[model samples]
Target: MVTTCDIIRMMNRISQYRQANRLLVIMPTWVGDAVMATPTLRALRNLYRTAHITALTRRSNRPLLDACPWIDDILSAWPPQIKIQRDGAQGGVFGVVRRLAAGQFDTAVLLPNGIRSALTTMLAGIPRRVGYDRNGRGFLLTDRLAPRRQLGAFVPVPTLDYYLAIVRYLGAEHIDRTMRLFTRPEDDQRAEDLLVDAGWSRQIPLVVINPGASFGDAKLWPIERFAAVSDRCVDELGAFVAIGGASKERPLLQKVIDRASRPIFDLPGHGVDMKVFKSVVRKASVVICNDTGARHMATALGTPAASVFGPTDPAWTETGVAVDRQVRVDVDCGPCQLRKCPLDHRCMTRINPQMVFDHVGELVGWNDELKHKGQDQDNSVARSVGYS
Candidate 1:
């Protein structure tokens, strides 16, 4: 239904922002980037309390913010990179442009650094466009921030801060870099039902492991290593271990389960949507995952997490607030930031199970003394795990 003709017509009818009563946020296309953009959204909400704040993101990433209180509503716009090359959705590039145009937003905030984002907002007839001036799109922005770079490439700034700089440019003073997320009651109830059905007792401490990374296989740690860690949690820590998958990571999740000695509770492969998936993450005492969006999900939910890093730089995902437990090995080739590994995948492979399990133990504080002593105190577990 979204045609090039409709898109062009909308652009021709461009109107300047008088009061910016209605605002549109052009969210990052990737899930990890989307999660990192939460603080910026919160800042926008605080600054413009009366304005209607709507987030425009990819269809898949849209569900992750279902319970986010900062935005009034969210809409999906599927572009080619995700729609055509990866996810088979009907909304092509033009369709996305068309949908964004129909929103009639006053001020648009471009989150992703892609030139396509700047171009689309301009085509949507959004006056007062704001974004980082990168990829030769400075001419398209009404207000643009020059990116910080070293020799030639941009610096590996923490993602939350990288997004928050735009908010500062918009005249925000006090910056809160706290990454946050929420879950619905219905989804929590559904998660409770499913967790119980899967033999997870409410009394047992929950440890969730995400073996899959949507980024690429380069970010994945060995499945056998994950299985070993799961078994350690069950045997040593006396915890209920669960493994989850995103959309296309079911087989990877299954492999972790198949190789494990103990029974692992399944989260995503059980037909739960991203909303329900988040509730499960919230209920977890500690989460273990690959360097993916799930790592940010856990942090946002205030659940202590342990992450395995490989191909990507840890500097990119670092939340300025929390000290997360991360397991990685220094290899010559990485953090190469490659989607696929060309040679031996030594960065991830060398990080053994014990390395991850030790950190998980620290995050969980699984011993009986620490558990019983800290039950009544606020953030006692977090304090113990050094989350703050």
Candidate 2:
């Protein structure tokens, strides 16, 4: 004499079981977030070593998925063009959900924390949909976690903690919070070859510069500032500099390369492929970049990095790395989460070239230089994000 609602609830509970088999994960499409998602994927793989693991990601971020050994298969939620429709498109949500429903995925973990991510999992009819209870799509999630209240301003919370919270809601515990990346020995050799081809000596310190940002103007620092830092690194520190960016960022990247006094290699436009990108990062001594995917990649390789922040908050999504050097110009209205800054972009503009130079000094073991120079000291950026 059980009611239909009760029957449905019981069935939903029953569906959470994975049959000791296959599982699918929906990874965040942004480069930095995708790299950060590696930890969660690792935990799942470690728990279900024999289970087939598939990851769903946007086409643009496929490189990150390819670099992650934890993911066995990578599925795209939308065609390449329709991927970013999540920025504000309603139809994009239903469309992606329709695609997800066809995957026959039994369980889905949504790490992006978007309304559409949960809806897609629910539409896929994934019985066990795990995610945070924000984004107004909480009703669709079977296992929902409340967002962390605050992890403090200076002490950035590692991203693994946030992703693990969702999995813990479903009784998956005993997972360590260490952030790690997987790459083959050959990949490391290839990175070494890239450095050799650039005519750099083996012992000299290497610094990679990534001045481009896809998360709007909020996370990008000025190109001129990057060029200025590269000049200083080469002229004063004798470090080799390699400018990395996608095709769209080539023009600005070239501008930086052109202005430098020492030798610089521009590997822009020609898609460096994700595998090679990670290899290049692993070989570098340090990377100076914006709060984009490259910053996270460098960190994952256990390399020191100097990150510049702007409109985006690094608090919500920041990850762990040994080095703590970061530079961002904090304004009253910074971290506004706007695609384009409404104000004069004071947050990024105010983060002068000298500020980043100082951070770079700290990470590269040149802290004494900053002390002697007596440069201005301040932290940068908003809305927490990832680093390595």
Candidate 3:
């Protein structure tokens, strides 16, 4: 005679054999990682054309995917949408469990390697859970893929490859790893309105300077360096320079404008969401930013972009955009991958604005002018994050 436990195990085995008619996806928390996961989303759609897919993501990143046609629904795990008591956060986790359980998803695709993501899907009773089996949660996933590692440390592969590996396990055959993003009509109109309000026209080249980094102060290249670049672009290149930051980061934008010699269009006070932000980035002739979400955003739109790297390793975000470029000053202590610097932050301080502009100049096609003047393109930052 089979016991209750034996019956439940048998049911789970049978459920794993069923088709993934309804799917739930747990998106990465960081904005760049979420954008990187788009390929996986697309691959899943191509493989299961009729499956109703609901993606659970942070509230801040929901707007990024609002215009994506492949996803059927977006659920927020963050607060305000699903208000959680600060004192009783466990209640909120259970609340998420309840909501996910009600969806009755047949399979869950965990994009992040966090154990919490695995445990949540496991508790939701999703029959088939797929994810990288690390972080002591291998038991939570029914289909586990060991992440590429060397000597017990995870290898830094491109995020596009890391996220796509999950879908490939499901028999997806997406060879095109190019990341894509979409914006609504209103998003485009809003970008235009912002430009028009700032005395910008299509005649002038638009250079979008991203000054604020959500990853923390360690990731931030000096704001004064950004100001210098903006002034040079407007004065020398005859470009319309615009600085962007989150609402909280608006003050950083003001600081750049205050230090800049020429007028800079400020995009922080306008309450720009990710959708509107995408339209603005898409329209930019070149985007210069720290290693942050804007870098990935520009990559997705196929916009020429240059980025400054600090504590983080550049190897983690290879999007296969041939035009994309970056610069990072070499330091003994980094890429330490620390959120905040314990030392003097020599990694960011050594990188000067000109080193960055060299890459930006190349992206903007300054070949003829630079060559005419006979300026050497070689620089210190060119050695690793090359094309300086």
lDDT of 1 by residue, 161-261 (tens): 88898777676669777777777889989998999887787567789998888788788898999999999999998889888877678888899999999
Task: Name the candidate, 2 or 3, with the larger TM-score value.
Answer: 3
Better of 1 and 3 by TM-score: 1
Can you tell me which runs of candidate 3 are displaced by over 4 Å?
Answer: 1-18, 78-91, 366-388
Which ten contiguous residues of candidate 3 have the minimum total lDDT? 379-388
The per-residue C-alpha lDDT of model 1 at residue 92 equals 66
Poorest 10 consecutive residues of model 1 by lDDT? Answer: 376-385
Query: Once superposed on the true structure, which residue ranges of model 1 sit more than 4 Å away at CA?
Result: 1-19, 80-90, 321-323, 366-387
RMSD vs true structure, all candidates: 7.6, 7.9, 7.1
- TM-score-based ranking: 1, 3, 2
Error of 1 at 41 (Å): 0.6
Local lDDT at 179 for model 3: 74
Global CA lDDT computed for model 2: 0.70
Q: Can you write out model 2's per-residue Cα lDDT over 55-129, one digit (the tens) per residue?
A: 888777665665567777887653323354656453476666666666677677778877767766776677777
Instruction: Judging by TM-score against the true structure, name the best candidate.
Output: 1
**What Cα-based lDDT does every candidate model obtain?**
0.80, 0.70, 0.80
